[model samples]
Target: MDTPSSSARVCGERPFYDLHAEAYDLIINDPVKPWCDAVDAQLARSSSILDAGCGTGRHAAEMIARGHVVDLADAAPRLLAQAAARCPSARTQLIDICLLPTADHDAVMCRGVLNDMVSDGERAAAIASLARSLRAGGKLFLDVREAEASRERADGEPRTRSGFTSRTTWDNGLLRVRETYAMGGDVVEYQFTMRPWSVGSLTGLLRDNGLRNVSVGGGVGRRTPDRLFVVAF
Candidate 1:
């Protein structure tokens, strides 16, 4: 298996989560209740859950609230600190998803994180690591956007939030997103590059990593039509 080097090579060791840790919770206010409900339906009350790549403990908070033993892990330390603050009772750690510590979990969730890995090797390593973190019958839950739809939407127009303006374009067959933050005349620029995945490709990749019983469905709770929600055992 290959070690994950995309974060370092493309956007430093911690990537966007660490860079924007302070603004993450504020910027990402999308209601996670529905997504949590969907995942909750798949898990037992006492399941040992590992929220791998959990950013600021959104899902972890829900699981912990439901009386599950949830461990929150992320590659970004600042983000992990935020997760720790949000869910003080649950264990929080700074961990790379592609190099997770060996532990038997009843279910492991890698939500909205795998696409951050810019290369196939990094994505593969992350999946394999998730497999290793699971117990014999443990299941894995993940969600990602459809490549074609993402490309079309991104290329369609520019968008802005707060003081940040972003536009997506194609570069060398990869999606390149350029974001500029206006900070009182001093503008800061950031770029993110990602490769999109199809449902078939994602399902195959999970199975290739020894994750069986793979299934893909509409995005969690059917809120997002363009997203692909994946479940595997």
Candidate 2:
């Protein structure tokens, strides 16, 4: 039987992260080696990196260990706190990607964040903000869900990990997800929406934001099936 406290309610991305912060690392612990390898291959030695939308600072911590200067930024305070705790040496900012500083880093790695921008205007603004965060000739690395593949897999059975159970459904162009965490006598639930990206549409957005030399490839690590790893300069 389900917990009596279980309730369904819509939530935005920030609130979802804030609620999920404590369980995030355990639930979403995919290996970071592949992504770090990609970054190493593309960036200069000892490059300064901005881990935009960084959740728990896993990537930033790894990048710092590999001799790169990494700063973390995210809109969710709870998530950012966890990130800072994980990477105490790295600088952190509590700000959205759309308001990131201009020309500040040698490269920016934004993983699993773009899909949350459900509107074209929000997507455009985000890309533009990321572009502005780059120094001249700097690169941008993005990991996002591929629309077709994600939609095809959206209706899969519920997945439980780290005391959380998650189910997803694709409707129209949105991927709606519900996550429930039940531990001891307490239960928490969150629902959120995401809009995946197609190659052509994403490419056009990058170009419009003055980000050229776009390359889209298969996902890194465990995300290979339904995600796209994109690189732009």
Candidate 3:
């Protein structure tokens, strides 16, 4: 849902969140506890965690509530501000997933972000960067919108929030969503392109990046199986 323009890369996706940061929580009401449970269950030890693209810092706050040391990172400074307010104790960093800092983390989580990479190269680079952020034997938990599910959603109803209306359409393997927002007298249109990766393909990507024990399952605490949560060590 956060994919950027071809010319601008992931950095281009920041404006959407920055503009909609105040209404982000209202639009996206997914509970964070289940994801926290899933991450906790897979952790061999809970010494430290890196929450990549930690929008609003809910995940980091949940992890911190569980007594795990947390580092919250995101490309959007506006979102990072919100995250900092939510989890005051977390170490906040302005980071890009494709160029994560070298650190040995017990677990690294990147939920609902991989699909944001519109190209294969960006996805590979992001996965490799996350792998580098992990220590040996550390687990990585990531989730992406399944390709089939994206195709199915193309036929669903459109959603609207904070003067913005969004509708999805699928062409070939790309999932495209067009959002139109009413900003006072001006109307702005934001179009995002995401490549939905299947579980098999995602598993291959993780293993190719030197990550092992990759497994894919339904998204944590979500009734719809559209999101595939992948765990690798």
Best by lDDT: 2
Q: Is candidate 1 or candidate 2 better by TM-score?
A: 2
Q: After superposition, how far is residue 214 of candidate 1 from its true place, in Å?
A: 1.1
Candidate 1, 35-76: lDDT as tens digits = 788878998888899998778898889888888899988777
110 in model 3: Cα distance from truth in Å?
0.4
Q: Which lDDT values do the candidates have, in the order given?
A: 0.76, 0.81, 0.79
Candidate 1 to truth, TM: 0.89
In order of appearance, the predictions have TM-scores of: 0.89, 0.91, 0.89
Weakest ten-residue segment in model 2 by summed lDDT: 1-10
Candidate 1 lDDT at 89 equals: 87
Candidate 1 stretches with Cα past 4 Å from truth are 1-4, 8-16, 183-186, 221-224
lDDT of 2 by residue, 1-233 (tens): 12110111121243346655666777778998988998888877889999998988888998998889998988777888888999998999987677677866899999987888777777887889889998888899999999999999898469887778889999998899887887555587777788899999999989988887999999987644999989998
Off by over 4 Å in 2: 1-16
lDDT of 3 by residue, 1-233 (tens): 24432423543353357775676676566888888888887665456999998888888898888889999988777888999999988898887787787889998998777887777778777888889999988889887889998798776368876677888888899887787777555577888887888888888888997886988887786656678888898
